[model samples]
Target: MSEPTAPQVPAIPTARRQALRQHLMNEVTRPARRPQRMLVLAPAAAVLAVVVAAGVIAQPWAPRSAPLIVPVHQGEHVGAPLLLNQMAVAAADTPPPGEGEYVYIRSRVAVAELGDGPARLGPAYEREIWIPRYERGDGLLRQPFLELPVIGVIPDRTTLPDMPPNAEVVDLPGDPDELLAKLHRERDERGRGSSRDGAAFTAIGDLLRESLLPPPTSATLYRAAARIAGVEVVRGVTDAAGRRGIAVARTEQGRRDEWIFDERTFEYLGERSYLVADTADGPAGTVLATAAVLRRAVVPERGQRP
Candidate 1:
């Protein structure tokens, strides 16, 4: 009180006062840590983008049912009908040209060139067939039961065996309903005959599944390959007059096989088995069987007469 010296100021601690001022300055001047400067939103954005990308990679190019209906079975459609119409069976005692298996049936047969075409008939080199010598009641050819008509289109050199003038050609007995009525009628009327044997190239070609084929045979495969390649069937078999079936197909493997059927019925006619070579006239394969063992028969006309 006395001296009023330096007007006594309230006691202030220098260190405390300095610290309080510094704290205030820091709170006012620093930039709030810039919201932690963190790019956390960037990571969330990246996660969302990744999710969108995953959904776009899972689908097919086309519908699904468009691949199976393209290849139609036109080959059989074209040839089978004609084949059924003209097909017939013939017989063989010994082998025909190659290796024939059949030995004895009811009818008899001999190799005779009914026609003089250039094409080789059946699977064997020597062309032969299973014709009928009997006749039925199908009406008469040219004359009224005067001459026994030929059972097959092709012909054979038969002893004519005192044939009843009109007997069915039993070369291929496998046929069922094919030429039966005609055969019986011909035999009954003329004693023997040859009616359904000769077939033109268009006809045979119509039946041929192209030409040379691959192994693992099946009608389906043959028709497919044949249509794809534009191949042709045997042409110009000597028109000398021999009724027989054709070994219509060949394998790249050399297998050559044909079937001879009964004109009356579509029986499992005689079969020709042999092989072909890229070159050479000699048979590269062999003939397996003939009229000796005919399969069942085939009937085409449906409920036609006998």
Candidate 2:
């Protein structure tokens, strides 16, 4: 290789150099060169200053808090907006008069919607129940008790009402058992008819509401789970509803997911099971996930996510 070459400077006119220096000095000291855009940029500067001030005092421009979705089950809105078609759920009814009461389940049912709008919820379906039977009894039974299951449908925007008492009659039917059956049927039908969903729906709604509203007795996660399940739990914490609850979850071995929720309502946090298909305007899909509390009794019939 040839010998290394030393860098050389090109000659510039002294007057040109002085002019450049003067221009730089003027830029620095000439009243800061009053930008040609003082008026154009003033509002933006003011807004930026305001935003910074707000961050210092109120955090107005700080990022918002994350959504919250605590469900009794796992996968917030992954499957579908929270809904059960038909559920054979057990409810308590009169058991032995002197002994403890046994659980009586509704043989059939249709779960209700949680929030407003048709897109978010599903239709009602049939359900059945199961209970244990077959116990030896003392001879000569006077008052035998059995709870028969009933079916119910919920009407839009309705509330449940209490059942009326049985009427006293002097006359007697030829068959007392048949009369009893007729009476029960009438009562069940009437109970269901008066309210948007009948007595059955009312009771189920009540039970769920109780399950959802909460501030657990304690702060332990296990205790919180116990509350939602309705076990006689010891040492749990209350959720927003002020009742103890066990946070229900559904997860396989290893998967990371997030539950998106409305920041204001703090309702359920969930995600759609699949990506929403695109539409003319944009990606088209309903809210796929949600967290709901029955006890909260906040089933929206027709309202926006507040």
For this target, which candidate reaches the highest lDDT against the unseen true structure? 1
Tens digit of lDDT per residue, candidate 2, span 109-225? Answer: 111121121222122122111111112111110111211111111122221112110011111232323333333454464453322212222222222221221222111212212
Off by over 4 Å in 1: 1-81, 84-243, 246-252, 278-291, 294-306
lDDT of each: 0.23, 0.21
* lDDT of candidate model 1 versus the reference: 0.23
Q: Report the number of the highest-TM-score candidate.
A: 1
TM-score for all models, in order of appearance:
0.20, 0.17
| Model 1, span 1-306: residue lDDT tens | 573222122333667545534432222121111112110111111111101111121011112121111111112224543443333211111122222221112211111111111112222122111212232222111101111111111122221112111122122123233223332343344332222221111112212211111121122223332332222233211111244432233222333324333334333333332335432212333221222222112122212111
Which 10 consecutive positions of candidate 1 have the poorest summed lDDT?
A: 140-149
The clash count for each model shown is 104, 34
